[model samples]
Target: MFDSEIRYIISSGQRKKPICQNIVLLQQWLLEQGRCVVCGSFLTKGEKKPFGTGLKIICSCNQVYFYLPLANLYKRLSQNLYKL
Candidate 1:
């Protein structure tokens, strides 16, 4: 599901647009994944330390999503239908 959404966003524009540039957007993405937007950890991982993707996102009790590779993602819309 996530892949498709990402693909749609990238495919439609076909431009190198940063996937996210603010905290709100990041939190929304994490929330959709059932993760604590502030902590950036799966809610199912009870009592376990929130091992964030990197030290940058770690925060008190919750996480602050800082980075996601979606940025700079671009897809070429052209398809070379002709065969050599």
Candidate 2:
């Protein structure tokens, strides 16, 4: 459900994107689920503050999942262009 919502945000491509906060929320949700995001074995949250615009999580399968905002990516790029 959460993953699907993130995908929807990407597919929408309108004016909304998955922000860092949203990703954080997703991580929390996944933690509650107690399931890995990669192999669905088990989930282990890494203790690290959100840097830039992404979150990092490790699964029991030794798989790492990084959640980054979708729309914010382009928005950030456009902002950078304006600075140039």
Candidate 3:
């Protein structure tokens, strides 16, 4: 999943600002890292799945979506979009 630095960012309540307005860039960064955007410890996401089920994203570490709002939004959107 996520790395130590990303975990710290997530835990510290400092997650602010969107990582990137352009989802494409965000996606690229995630694929490059090859981990989960949501911390490995996230309870609601289910299993030890490594981000993206059949969606366009491949989020990993590097603290891209430390902003919970953005991460959640992307996940939600991707889930919905994946169905289509």
Candidate 4:
């Protein structure tokens, strides 16, 4: 099993900002899901936006996540492992 820690930085326009941390658990749970947790778009990194950029995951809870090129949904699932 592969495990990695992920960190995200958000700008609040001011000097103060918020930081979020998460762990990426590479396991079969994600592999068997076979669908985007945010959107059921077949979870392919090849998917692109109309503007010719990579597609992003927009959750119903208003959370925005991005998947790296050629990455699968498993990579994006790491975001859900965050503890706020």
lDDT of 3 by residue, 1-81 (tens): 556554343423775333344445555455344434445323233322233443233233222322133334333233444
In order, the Cα lDDT scores of the candidates are 0.41, 0.46, 0.37, 0.39
Give residue 7's error in model 4 in angstroms: 21
Clashes of each: 4, 0, 1, 0
Give per-residue lDDT, candidate 4, residue 57. 47
How high is each candidate's TM-score?
A: 0.29, 0.29, 0.21, 0.26
lDDT of 1: 0.41
Q: Give the per-residue Cα lDDT of candidate 1 at 7.
A: 43
> Candidate 4's residue-wise lDDT over 1-84, tens digit each?
222212333345544322332112222344345444444434444333321133454444433444544654334424553322
> How does residue 42 of candidate 4 score in lDDT?
45
Query: Which scores higher on TM-score, 3 or 4?
Result: 4
Judged by lDDT, which candidate is best? 2
lDDT of 2 by residue, 21-63 (tens): 5676665665456555445454334332244576444444545
lDDT value, residue 75 of candidate 3: 34
Per-residue lDDT of candidate 1, residues 43-83 (tens digit): 44523222233112333464333323344121111224111
- Residue 13, candidate 3: C-alpha displacement in angstroms: 25
Q: Model 1, 17: alpha-carbon shift in Å?
A: 12
